[model samples]
Target: MTVLSQEKPLPKAKTGEFWDHVQFGGGFGISAGNDYTDITIAPSAIYNFDDNFALGLGLQYSHLKQRNFYNSNIVGGSVIGLFSPIEEIQFSLEVEEIHVNNTYSDLYNNIKKSFWNTGLYVGGGYRADNVTIGARFNVLFDKNKDIYGSAFMPFVRVFF
Candidate 1:
């Protein structure tokens, strides 16, 4: 059997009505507050399964060229979980890592060194339409015990 009917095409729903969604953006970061500069060109993606459950992934590649500091290369990713306890507010947990080179300074030319950096972060944000502002605390532990070993990094993110 064959049947044909004519009807108007349905319009897409607004952001509030969609059950699933994705987001993409670029990111840049630096190690210290300021002494040298490092940059990253990153693209991040997010998918929401429902109002209270979501997942995300992000990739970043960084290049460090010596102007007055040591040169290095960095690459990384993040797997994120998003949940809502109350309306318009969401919580997240991220597992991420970065790799860089170890340079022997003029002061410590005879020392042999290597490093691999890793961390986990937990944060939350308030969502308004498509934009969010949030804060995170990252506990970073470095390999070089000779230098400053570990510290906590508190940073804020603006995402859409």
Candidate 2:
């Protein structure tokens, strides 16, 4: 028997591209000056522009259940660039505008005496199958309060 082939191969993709993923996940972690437990609930979504870059949106509301901070409501998004300088490691750059609740302000207070606020958070992340972990540094863009005082959190995201 003899066979003939008449098929063309596909083109190659660029490196450090994350334009092939649509991600949705949730996270729970803690924060403080030390080993303190701060229960946080955050749901997030992302659209990859390449295999190495993505745009993300997240909505998070956290109560200082058993820690140092008070109740806060945050909604923000960021543009992330994925870089893999080594195997088994992924680094991401994030610039996000997070709106938080200022519990003590000069305006009318509702929603747990929380006032409106906005902040810019820069962070990095590492990805794994069915999980993602990262840390963030935030700068409040408001003149009311500075919550978190900048928090270092190790977060895990469960993909569904």
Candidate 3:
């Protein structure tokens, strides 16, 4: 009599393919000075289409107050595109549209204004397995709209 051998099945993948997963993270920043203070929080999601390209979207909120003078609130959304030809570096470009509300108070009068504005940012930076550190420039910067005081900005991100 001859015996037959049984075959074993391969393990199944739980999360599906590499492109099927999404990465998420958020960032925060705060600054204080003698006459001014600013705070910002941004949350984002990204989907990698492949080893070299990805796309993302983000939401932003910012608050600014100056000593007994004026205060502003901003809310916006952004879209981003990223490319990495090398393993440890990547390039990114982003565009954002925001709405700003400002209120000013003084001995004379108190006034308020609201408007919608847009900004463009382009930069490149070093990237590791789950973190990236980069500096970007605002290509479409307006002094009234860019509360950050400069066209150059630095950023850090983490993905899971």
Candidate 4:
């Protein structure tokens, strides 16, 4: 006699699967000297739609001082999009906007200046595990009003 066996179908995936793909990453820095002080904090989160695509948001804050020269506060936010064409390469595009407030001091006077700045960055980097190292350029960089000395910046990112 011959017997026949049947296999059951697999179950479907549950809802709210999007939350499973979220990742977080950012960095901070602090420095102080007899005549200078700088502090920065930035935090960000991203949601991966798939293995190769992600969208995210970030926040930034910085405090800087030069004794008897200038003191400044900077606050900003950014929106970023990431794509990985292969396992080892990733590319990104980001838009950032920040407000800067500066107070300058001299022997006899104090001056205050405030303004908003925006940057559009395009970059690519090498990826390994949860880290990416690369350089980015600001398409909207203006040396006169931007905080960075140059339009190009190097970055290292880590996510889990």
TM-score of each: 0.64, 0.51, 0.80, 0.90
* Quality of model 3 by C-alpha lDDT: 0.88
Q: Report the lDDT of model 4 for residue 120.
A: 99
lDDT of candidate model 2 versus the reference: 0.54
Best-matching candidate per lDDT: 4
Off by over 4 Å in 2: 1-20, 28-40, 63-81, 102-116, 139-144, 158-160
lDDT of every model, 2 decimals: 0.64, 0.54, 0.88, 0.95
TM-score of 2: 0.51
- Reference-based lDDT, residue 109, model 3: 88
RMSD for each of the candidates: 6.7, 7.6, 3.9, 2.3
Tell me the tens digit of each residue's lDDT in model 2 across 1-160.
9999887877667653554466777666667655334557677777755555555666666654323333445555444445544433556555554555534322454335444444455555576754567765555433346454444545454555
What tens-digit string does per-residue lDDT give for candidate 4 at 15-89? 767768889999899999999999999999999988899999999999999999999999999999999999899
Q: Residue 80 lDDT in model 2?
A: 48
Global lDDT of model 4: 0.95
Error of 4 at 57 (Å): 0.1
**Lowest-sum lDDT 10-residue window in model 1:** 145-154
CA displacement after TM-score superposition, residue 34 of candidate 4 (Å):
2.0
Error of 4 at 121 (Å): 0.2
The candidate with the higher lDDT, 1 or 3, is 3
**Residues 20-132 of candidate 1: C-alpha lDDT, one tens digit per residue:** 46666546665544556567677777777777877888886886554444656667777878787765787888887666555534543533345556667777777676555
